[model samples]
Target: MLQACLNGGRMRDFHPALPFTATEIASDAALAVAAGARELHIHPRGPDGAETLEPEHIAETLQAVRSAVPGIPVGLSTHWRIPPGGLSRQEPIRRWTTLPDYVSINLIEEDAEDMIALVLGKGIGVEAGLWSVSDAQRFVGLKDAAKCLRVLIEINEQDIDEGLRAAAGIQAVLRQAGSTLPILMHGDEASVWPIYSEAMARGFDSRIGLEDGNLLPSGRMAGDNAELIRAALALAPR
Candidate 1:
């Protein structure tokens, strides 16, 4: 299913039009859903414009989006304000609630197992986020693969050509795990369109939004998340 990454890992300094408040995010979520997004991925931000894992912030964001687009599955990122060694802390995970349909956990951080366990115990779906092939392999190696909930393999542009190669590696890992779990692939920044098109060609579910890139396929600034979704749909193989 196509998802809309409303916002994640973004700051006001990165893009002047990036959505920061619940109101703005709600508007974007509605537009994206109307544009064919079945799921919504969002990262709640605090008043200072920094990513926040606070329960209240997440609640407000979820509330707004749910009010705007009822019944659309929503997911939140657990990579909030994550520092080099901050994943071990229980504070962030403690704040997560079932309000969001899914919560993404980056494998790069420490104590990933514990965090995943907590999320599962809370009955929340998990989106295993892989930034590199190594991370994908590690995820595949994890025991009880069924607990992952859902998986989203993220290919960052900084990895360059390795991005597509990493996607292939992830497919291999999924094969070895013997899991037919739903997988979605997408890229960040200027590389989003290329990888998105490639994802569709490979017959993979995917997503797009300001979180991935603020520019449209035409290289112009996208006015909103709907614009990006429309661009992605246009690029999808007919």
Candidate 2:
């Protein structure tokens, strides 16, 4: 599956075209899906143009996107940086009155286990995010690790070689731990295109969008998420 991470922690300062409101996100969703994206992941923002975990914000965002693209599988981020009390995913998970089809939880977080348990209880699927080899072990050690919807192998290393190496290391740990869940892998800005191509080469689900990076494989800034998805599709093997 090809997912589009519409707007992450990225803001207007990073790119003027980054979507902030529900209507903007919904428009991006419609265009991206039309261009071949199979799934969506978004970071909801507040009235102040800052990332937010507020239920009203999430509901408005989800509702708009769902209305624009009825069957698209949407997911939200449990990023700790959003709230004033940084490093707390549990708080948002606790406060959420609205839920997405799934949510991404970084296993490197302090409250990873508890938050995962809570999300599962709410009948919301979990995207076990592995940011490093250590994170892979963290997921493997979970009580019902296999029950997660999918594993997200995210490489933050900007150096292409180092990032690809990081991806391999995480994958090795998961294999050693007998993890059989499907993987949705992608990389940081400098490594995204190469790693995305690698993911496709290995038959793994991959993603792209403003959240990942603004650049295309040719090193030019993408016009939008739809253009990014179209470029990604061309890289995939037929």
After superposition, candidate 1 runs with Cα above 4 Å error: 80-85
lDDT of each: 0.79, 0.89
Question: What is the model-wide C-alpha lDDT for candidate 1?
Answer: 0.79
Q: Per-residue lDDT of 1-238 in model 1, one digit per residue for the tens?
A: 7899987877766676678899989988998999988899998777876777777777888899899999999998777354222654457557656368888888765666677787777888888887776777777777745777667888885556777787778778778778777888888886687788877987888999878888888889888788888888888878
Angstrom error of the Cα, residue 40, model 1: value is 0.7
Q: Write the per-residue lDDT of candidate 2 for residues 1-238, one digit (tens) a residue.
A: 9999999989787677899999999999999999999999999889887888888888999999999999999999886677754556466667777789999988988877877888898989999999998899889999968889999999889888999898999999988998899999998888898899889988999999999999888999888889999999988888
| Every model's TM-score | 0.91, 0.96
Error of 1 at 44 (Å): 0.7
Q: Which stretches of candidate 2 lie over 4 Å from their true place?
A: 87-89
